[model samples]
Target: DKRIVDWTNAQNEWKRREIVLKYIASKGDEHELYALILDNRFVHHHRSVTQVRMDLNIAERTFNRMQEKALWEAARIIPANVLVEK
Candidate 1:
């Protein structure tokens, strides 16, 4: 079923990767983190890009740009502005 293989799955996969990246980053495992990201099952995998781009509702370039922006935001070094008084 081609319809079943459309943007919905791609979007879901992308969201899953978004969370997974955050989770891995939290774990602080430098060695396995790269491998997990590169694994084919993850949406960010090298081979999945074509299908993800074509199937997603957004344009390929837009999606790529958004992903890059998200990575930058996640990696920003600034600490939280609001400090707890306790």
Candidate 2:
């Protein structure tokens, strides 16, 4: 029972993350924004900010600002009720 509960929690967390990623990827400047979020290490393991900036050819300050904005948007986009186990 305990192990099942733990596994369920982990699975739910992974699902929640996937939902958020999909939501972000679907809405607005999808390609650029998603790439910015992914490349700048918003959700998954990613390249360092410096490397991402170089790869994306974005300014450091702009990248930082976008990363912040992306996080804020992701927080707002994520459903509050999704975490509640059904």
Candidate 3:
């Protein structure tokens, strides 16, 4: 039962990550969107939000807004179980 639970957790995590990445990739030519992914460490190596802000040359408020928007978009696009293959 423990093993099954662990496996289920792993699968869920993978699915969540996949959905977020797909959402990010769908937004074409939005540097802020891509930068949010990098800042959040969704892909590639992780970096501090401060570093991401500096690298993207965006202010703190802007970075926070972008992060919030990216998360909102990902949440909006995540499919209900009825729409996903078992």
Off by over 4 Å in 1: 1-5, 29-42, 45-86
Q: Model 3 over residues 1-86: C-alpha lDDT tens digits?
A: 99999899778866676656666776776744653554355445577788777877879998878777776666566556413443
Instruction: Give the per-residue lDDT of model 1 (tens digit) for 21-52.
Output: 56545655542333243333234556565665
C-alpha local distance difference test of each model? 0.49, 0.69, 0.65
| lDDT at 30, model 2 | 46
User: Candidate 2 — worst ten consecutive residues by lDDT sum?
Assistant: 30-39
Query: Backbone clash tally for model 1?
Result: 0
Best model number under TM-score: 2
Of 1 and 2, which scores higher on lDDT? 2
Clash statistics: count for each candidate: 0, 0, 0
List pairs with backbone clashes in candidate 3.
none
TM-scores, in order shown? 0.33, 0.66, 0.58
Q: Model 2 clash tally?
A: 0
Q: Residue by residue across 1-86, what tens digits does model 2's lDDT show?
A: 99999899878876787777776777767445754565358446566888777877889998888778776676676677553434
